[model samples]
Target: MRKRKTPDFLAQAHDPADPNPWLALYLDRSTPLPDEVKKSWLTDSSSNSRQYLLPLLRPIARGFIILIQVLKIFLPRKWSHSRLLHRVLAWGLTRFVSPEANWLILRHFHLGAQILAFIAANSPVPITTTPLEPRNIDDLKDDLFVKHDLNLFNFVIRLNQALRDAGVEMHPPARVDFSMIRDPGLRLEDMPHTRLNFLDLQSAIELFTPLYQLMLTDNDFWRAANSLQLDETIGIYAARLMGAPEHLILVNNKHPLVPMSTLRAGYRLVLHGLSTEMLHSLLMDRKAAQEQPPAEI
Candidate 1:
């Protein structure tokens, strides 16, 4: 039998010269960003200028943000994840919130998290440079790249525990090892190598999709899980910030790392008041432009 070739990403993961694992992962895209665009984004500006406003409007925007946060404290914990609550809030904001306030909050609060995560992961900090694997989950408790508002580390830990308690089993031929549950300290590096392909991705998604759906629907689980649900616009913006190509951003591409069902649920719940056309332009993949036909002279 011919020896199987290692995927470029997996090979890169093992490369010692690659100091920053997260950056390596970002660059390992099946559809990569153009070199020029990537360079411009890195060198030109760290943030969107439109995401800011005149200095005078800053205080007003801050007040609105604080009011929202204060209101959230008074809300019933269960209602925090309620779809009805999400829609109601979105609707009210759409009707009452100023465009500037909305943009400021989403940009500063939502996209800001992603920006911080990117910087932390790529920084020279040794702990942050560690490869993002199951083993290092505990170390990443406060990490922005891996742990979003939801505290993904705790979420994964709780999820694994929930699966085991529920006696959930994987499909035939792939018995549920519950490895993550069994060995709380288990690391991805310790596991045997297995080729990851589209089929594998599909199977994983299928297996976990229902579990995620159940979690979202279960008020008790959500409250105990302590996950933070984001607005659709913020979710979309965060995706773009993660170096997701324009095609994926426009279609709201569902990366396997996060559940697609959850993302769609946010879109339905929160009205960001952003048109799809505007979003497409904001996150346009310059690389994709190469595929377009030339304009007439």
Candidate 2:
């Protein structure tokens, strides 16, 4: 198990007062900004000759994502899952991608996995997905499937969270079954053979370092990634299948061209507003149902 190196920028002390220090980097203007944070704003290519071509290369990054979506359709599914290709992509990410960007990518996976595991444990119905036990970056290079699983599980968790928030009484899925996700210590070594679905194209999307690096900075990359909406809808339909179709908000794939932190803040704001409206509507319906007199047997 090769250990991943922590980025200097992320390793620095953040404002302990801020609830989410990493997120505060983009959102909270008042948050403490250290020198390392300022330095991270520079492009990875800033020190090299390629810095001159950044303007031209930067615009190409947007087109690359569109190109990949089209290209994947014509290519065989297996071609994207090649272990050698994944290793090459990992090397590019390690070398060319900024430390902050790499950290965010890995951090996104870890956070997403943890949230999904939480939802799976508390789900009223079984979320019969594979346990997303990801290895460290080096081990992941040879098996990108774990990354794909994380994305899919995250999609599930987002819906589950939304459901739980909407007055659903959630409980452990089974009386004696040990399949549900719990603390990491009890996680299965590998998912059962029947659960393996070798169709995670999200990993391929993530490994496009050539195009992604051209986004100039980690924040820019975050903007581009969010605009693409690659992983947003992964488990939505599955969530609908579980229960309360009306409770889940309709996904809005259109992301504005803005700084990633700004976009994230805006996205959350929209979700909160919508959730409040939904909750009010649900409460009214429940009140009306209760007010109705009993029907004849």
Candidate 3:
């Protein structure tokens, strides 16, 4: 699945301006930003390669990510570095940075790279770059990545089947409800629109956090760093910061280890049979641009 372009940072990364890390990280797409932060981030990201080399370091980056997730999961405590960051950092470093593991770390920049850098230990660093796969999370064939069936190729294919079964067409439903739920055996049409709970399509992805963790562990550091996966991850980091909209049209591009999802050309992921005009509007962000304008827009 292409990383969500909506800029949700929490599941990805926390925006600088966000006051609450947990809340900021988890906010849905369509969330508003405090203008000041947006401009700062825009400039920070595009400023220079040196300013953003964090993406080049994967082990520490994933460590930072695991740190935040662990903190969020077990918050309201002392939250010590020894107890938190160290543990997750240890895990990430062992997984991606280990020289012994075979992966394409040298080719593309993946989200795992920055995440590795962010949480990697600054002191007692390895001088020879020896292999260190964390306990119970080894890259062996019996590891979690294969155990959970979390490969991108599989994820996209499954999602494609879902879209096919839904009979997804070029146009979104004119009166489609964003929030809806179905009772056991309840037909989708039987439920009133107002009774539906808003659906965050990303929820489907969240169902497999364990799998994503496996994905985090199995990747090669340098390859992920160059792929612009961090950029995509950061874009998601930004979107999480922004929060969700009243509605959204979800798409899963299903490509992997190549380009980050949200940053790639939209045409690559637009549903196969969409009309030219509709596809153009979407890729241009023109069709939905005026949607109840931003109050400020």
Winner by lDDT: 2
Question: What C-alpha RMSD separates each model from the true structure?
Answer: 22.2, 14.8, 21.0
Residue 156 lDDT in model 1? 35
Model 2, residue 13: displacement in angstroms? 17
The lDDT, on a scale of 0 to 1, for candidate 2 is: 0.39
What is the overall TM-score of model 1 with all chains considered together?
Answer: 0.24
- Separately for all candidates shown, the number of backbone clashes (residues 3 or more apart, or on different chains) is 0, 0, 52
| Model 2 residue 240 CA deviation in Å | 13
User: Judged by lDDT against the true structure, how good is candidate 1?
Assistant: 0.32
Would you estimate the TM-scores of all the predictions? Answer: 0.24, 0.39, 0.23
lDDT (10s digit) by residue, model 2, range 1-100: 1232323443455667755434344444432222332233222212232334434443454456556545656665434334555576666555454443
Candidate 1: tens digits of C-alpha lDDT, residues 1-297: 123232333234455765744345346545334332232222212212222322334344334434544554666554423343334434433343333222222232233333233323322221121223323212222332223334433433443455467665212121211111111233222222223211121122222223333323344333222232323333443343344344333333334244332323322212221222223233334324534699999
Lowest summed lDDT across 10 adjacent residues in model 1 is found at: 174-183
The residue ranges of model 2 lying beyond 4 angstroms of the native Cα positions read 1-55, 63-81, 128-135, 145-297
Candidate models: Cα lDDT each: 0.32, 0.39, 0.28
